[model samples]
Target: MPWQKTFTLGNKRKGCHLITNEVVNAIQDGLQNVPIGILHLFIQHTSASLTVNENCDPDVRSDMDMALDTIVPESLEWTHVDEGPDDSVSHTKASLIGSSISIPISNGRLNLGTWQGMPPPTVATGGARSRNIQASI
Candidate 1:
């Protein structure tokens, strides 16, 4: 049988930060007695996104966020400035990263590597924002 669950996370991005564990745990909790299957995670948003990355070191995530900001700096060069400078950059970041992730479920748990974890949701503003994540098991 396939099961599905939706979750939201509160994120306030100063620049770009990772939201670790919450989503993964939700998926795990949802799949808690499923035996074995595939887990599909989807985030319904463009300005923000989801990813699976190293969760062991906070510095790794910080460095990655910094690098992304440097690579796609918010400037006035984009034509999609109807919203703001961060608008295009937000879309660019979403395109570069992605809005969904899929993982394998085994023994009623997500079969992720020892060093792997659910990356934090990337928020574009300093204010509180919510991400809708759908987990299908």
Candidate 2:
């Protein structure tokens, strides 16, 4: 049988942060019995996204945040001002980064590259908020 669970992560900062361990911890119990399967993770927010990338270096994360800031600068003129300056750009950044990911589960473990892990994207919305994530295995 397949397993599914939804969990919320609270108060992530305004940039990419590694959450691989958190993800695993959230669904580890459900994953224990599965020998081989696929894990799909979906983030339920428009201003944030999910992606697998290098988790070894802190620079990689900072660089990504900087690059995205350049690519989708919050200073750009946008009509969606109800949220803040980062509003529309946040949506754009989320679209560019994506909101979901798939990973292979082998022997009840996530099959990811040595350097590849999940780093969630975030747009500085001026305040910290919760992010909902759904995991299916």
Candidate 3:
């Protein structure tokens, strides 16, 4: 049987955030007995996305945000500017990264790399805001 649930991540400024603990805590109950399975998470917004990365270093998160800004600079001319300058940039960044992630489960735990973690709500509205995430196990 598959287990599912929804959760919210509080708002933060424009940058990558380490959300592994938050996500795991929210879906901990569902992950308890899954000796072998997969955990899929989807963010319910276009402005923000999901990704796993090195959780040990704060620089990786900050650098990710910086790299994204470089990849999708706000100075460029964008057709979808209904919200503001960062609107289009935000969406583009989300698209470039993605809105979902899946990880393997082994012995009732996520089988991720030693240093890997489900961090970063990639981008956010106005470059930052709360994000709703749906988890399926």
TM-score of each: 0.85, 0.95, 0.93
Q: How good is model 2 by TM-score?
A: 0.95
Identify the leading candidate in terms of TM-score: 2
- For all candidates in order, the CA lDDT equals 0.73, 0.88, 0.85
- Per-residue lDDT tens digits for candidate 3, residues 1-137, read 79999999988677788888898889889999889999999999888888989989888888888888888888898888886778888888888889889999988788999999877635565545788999999
Rank ordering of all candidates by TM-score, starting from the highest:
2, 3, 1
Runs in model 2 lying further than 4 Å from the true structure: none
Candidate 3 off by > 4 Å = none
- Which candidate, 1 or 2, has the higher TM-score? 2
Which residue pairs of candidate 1 clash? 18-120, 19-120
Angstrom error of the Cα, residue 70, model 3: value is 0.7
Residue 104 of model 3: what lDDT? 97
Query: Of the pair 1 and 3, which is ahead by lDDT?
Result: 3
Which is better, 1 or 2, measured by lDDT? 2
